[model samples]
Target: MVNKAWRIIPRPLLETVLNNHAQHHRVPQPLILHGPRGVGKTTLILERLLGEWNKGPHLTGYIDFAESIEDHHPQFNKSFPWASWSNCPPPALSSCRSKLEHTLESMVEKGVKLGTISSHQIFTTLNKWHGLNTALRRVIQSNNAASKSAVVGKASPSVLWDRAVFALSARCNAQEIDGVLGLSEKWKGLSIEEASYFREAFLALRLAKEVITVQHGWRANAIAHLNRTGGFSRSLAHSCTDWPCLLLELLSQAAEIDHFQPKLVINNIDVLRNATLNDDSSVSASMYHDSLIWRMIALGANERCLPIILVTSDSYYSYQAYLDFGFTDIFISREMFGWTPQEAKMHMVTDYFSPSEWTVIAEVLGPIPRHLFELYALKQSDYYQKVMGDKGSTFEDIVDAYLAYLQITVVNPAMDNALELLKKFAVDARNGKISKDKLRFGAPWRHPPKTDDPTQCMEWAKLQLMDFVQCLVNTEFGDWEETLHSFFALFILLRLAVVGMIS
Candidate 1:
């Protein structure tokens, strides 16, 4: 049997180092694996952990939102998580938002119904990550006036608060929740008192979300409808403020009910930052709720819930960002997942590259894993053929012969306009060849956003895009036919979108 298509490089030491640190209940610390792009940040740091995290007692869930944008790029909000997760719901936004918040509060109050959001939605599936004593400590602190004042808020007579504590009691021990409040005759309750600090900061962060806004009834008299029949809806409509963040919070605490241990691996913590792009306040408010949920989990992760591993590339690592956003100090520097020059050398050696060739390429590319990988992908004449493949070119010639051949000869853009600076700089920022081509192609981008000759620009764009597709499908460079098929389908889709827009 032969298996060649699917594989990954083994980096067991890095994985072991991360697991050992995160799983340590005695002294857990978050690790940071930050490095420049092309240094194997994605492959080694992210992919390696993803490949082997399941072998342990914990289950991992990843959410990646990077490597989709590049260099000073401006992104449209039409993308998936970017769009749906960040955009506000239509029309009666206020009513929908109120209902959403009320729904969550109700879930916290009366136990979330089994078939509803608490038990059936994403949060339910994620309930295996138990938060033993995390919620209970909050209830304990909320109960004692001295502790409550010292920690978060004044002792307020709120029914929702009591209900929240009762709900917490179901997950944690019904009796132990009471016992933690009292210390044994021999031992002092110093640890419990100190631990209230964790609960306080988390609760303080969440206090805004729990604001009690009581609306007056429309009854003429007290007896109009004395008894309130039932409670809020269990499952909520998709229309709500901070829906994604709330969903994340609910998922994070889902396992808290029964004290099940599950690891949640949310990738690309950086992408959430984009929510602020549209309306900073709304996004910030939602993130506060998310932070509160993580804060609770983080405060008690060592002695309680399973490790919630958050992944991101070095470009947007959340280590400093977490602190900058006023999050509780829960993460420790887990590990720096980057290859050394020796490791890069080993990668080249493993790929069957000769020392003499790799040495020269390595010196030129400067030990970047991605750069090395791209160079190794093409065989002999791969280096020079790309450099001066078809010209009176010298090694000293300053030109991207590799990209030029790969573009025109291998993977060309529109036939004639391939060299046109406008289309070249369309998707990317003005850099290197793009800047030079601008002088040659004559800054067409300088035209108004709605150009005077829209049809010409449109035609040129269509031709360039199709030419790009042709190169992609060309087997000479790589077998990208299936990918090209998908691209063509997307082209048809874009056409339909354009038609719809016109209509």
Candidate 2:
């Protein structure tokens, strides 16, 4: 396994996707991968796709319109190796029409000699014909002449082919098709049949524009044209099934024909509630619903043969929603990323300070993780310099400042209740031979009661007992004897709750 803590891992998931893709002999129509921003969801997807494409003939395209003028225009292209494998362009309007003409002429010449004329034969024959620009034009002219008289001319392969290709190229524009087909001078090896498939697939790309337009109306004209011409029918539709019902239907056609799958991943779902709504309050009301659609599309795509993964933060928003939807297998952060305390400390120190400063910081902050200890140390250091003018203070001075700071700044009136409870426990325990019942006061008790409770009595009293015993053991009278005498005096006054003595 890869170092998941340091980076998002991809190999295991990629193998699963490739196996599924090969078994089905078609790419999944939808897949979703989601997670927190820094957790590397996008990195995982790109690496996995690149790995699979490296092993076989596959095309992978990526579009990150997160910062684009258009909200959802994907950047699509073939992956390497296959990217170098072949080059082909779908029939352009001018080129396809010309090819139909030439093919029809050849078929006519062949028919004249063969003498087997049938309407179905003509349609099927023309459909099967593969030709260049000249052949296409000949086919179109013949079909037009043949259909001049009928109420609605019987749809011929020549007519259907011409119309389909023309409509597709016109809507997509030359620049778009050039990008899609990756046209180059060295691209001449692609067969006419392969070119036709490209044309059909390009049409699917055009249809997918509907999804973009629904969210952003600025692209409406382009979207409408693609939809009318049936151009958006491929991966775009497959990836966008979680969109609106109408858009889903339009994109579904592409999936049906090509078996293209789409995947969705939703991460940081906890932030969904913080998502901004417009003046109309529309986005707010629909945010959860929209999130649901996102997951639904992912689930639907997975079931329809697409691999979908959803990554989420350790937040109730995502956890509760996935649980409610019964998508329990969806991976959580614990599986995606893990860090030991030491590793976490290392990251924090490296991120916030230089290597030379680590030793000094460790001294001040102790062995605790940087999150808890760094701020505490910095604040204490700052206060020491400001109040006592002692930048190079001794440990005793630092401890006294820390206690004072805690009393003055950290413990507010809001903490009065908790302090009172602690004080009550302290006072009760100080009274003669504090019982176990009194010691247990204010402590939380859970089921299967603890047998050996460590916090059963006062810590100060235990320490004083240890000191007295040490005095006895060593037979030392100087400071140890004085300490024992002071402790005994304090113990008697505490039992009596004498105001000036124990307080």
Candidate 3:
């Protein structure tokens, strides 16, 4: 059986550069690997690069934000990988976001645990930040009415102290208590502003302590405690800074313990932008900036000298993000390129494709690894069987069939009348109904056609095709204006290939 997806041809030169930047001696600047869709950026990092790096003592973490933001574009056929992978009716953005956040926290915690050499150090840090002593001192230092008379340097432990002690001691008892009653009471004494600040900081510390010490059901217990006490709030959702701070702190400590700066690979980070669009839920754009997740990670990488690689297929979205986050200067970008024809043939599976077959494949698909894979997959599909239907399974036959499949499944679903309009335009040019200048220059796509019957309008077809290319096609194709003619030429070639005119 032919594999639908194949391993990316290793780029020794690119890998060397990546390895140089990913050195453990010092933290490298954040790397943004930008490229067109399906150029093997994800596969390169996840499979080849990470696999090589994992052989060493270094630790690495990865997360894909795209997993949360599904493509809702309608796909008529599931024969091709791209169409099959795109979700029709995507899952709710809110649910997806919640899941992503949880996954991020979980990844952070797991990384911390894996790298932690001393739980005792973690316990001591937790005590210093949010233990009973810290809580009592916080109350004494408060400017609230309840603590007006309390001296910061020398203060007696109030009833709050005794209750907190009991809560701590109860951990050893048959029935364990959270030891937060006194802390929660004192937490309410401060002003609303102070309370919100105090709660996030305190809870973040508490969660870290629980994660390091308890190890199991810590997240559930923490959430249950918050819910039971009505402590969960909207501020904690997006605007929360404490958790992000804690995550960085924990990562730093883990790096210190492991004696090597761990690498962080975050893929499809532009999904932060995607999540905001068309979302009816409470998820907002401000969350990306206000929450310390992205910006904070960048800051942490620079400060701690941790190697952080942020991958995005969408350069425009990332550029906007870089500006909004005020870290345009921090990221060092590397543009991932597709294979060259000479290079592609060197790595091509000669056993599957003879020399002649590969020449035709290369000529049609250019040097794109993804297109080649999709074509290979299409040949083995039921769609291929339907297209071939007792015809010889030649390379040209499969290429023609793939083009037809793309038109019927991907293109037609998006723009129903595009192909028919092209056919009519071709006929119009042949019969002298269309002028020589019009045929040479092609249809003007200045404005969308204003007509009830869009299928009959060539301008509408051109505009619709441009729109589809902009959204569904790879961003590396340059401007839609420039690619418009090349795109139409593909359809024209498809028509010729189907009728055996191309040969």
The lDDT per prediction is: 0.38, 0.34, 0.51
Across residues 334-446, which tens digit of lDDT does each residue of candidate 1 receive? 44433556876776654546666556555544454544454444443345556557578644332244345434532232223232433433433323433433333323533
Error of 1 at 99 (Å): 21
lDDT of 3 at 90: 35
TM-scores for the candidates: 0.40, 0.36, 0.58
lDDT of 2 by residue, 58-125 (tens): 22223221211121212333211100000112112222212322332332222222222222333232
* TM-score of structure candidate 3: 0.58
Candidate with the greatest lDDT versus the true structure: 3
Task: Give the Cα error of residue 410 in candidate 3, in Å.
Answer: 2.8
Q: For model 2, give the 10-residue run with minimal summed lDDT.
A: 79-88
Superposed model 2: Cα runs more than 4 Å off: 1-166, 170-172, 207-305, 327-338, 345-503
- Predicted structure 1, TM vs. truth: 0.40
Residue 7's lDDT in candidate 2: 27
Deviation from native of the Cα of residue 263 in model 1, angstroms: 1.3
Q: Give residue 490's lDDT in candidate 1 (0 to 100).
A: 26
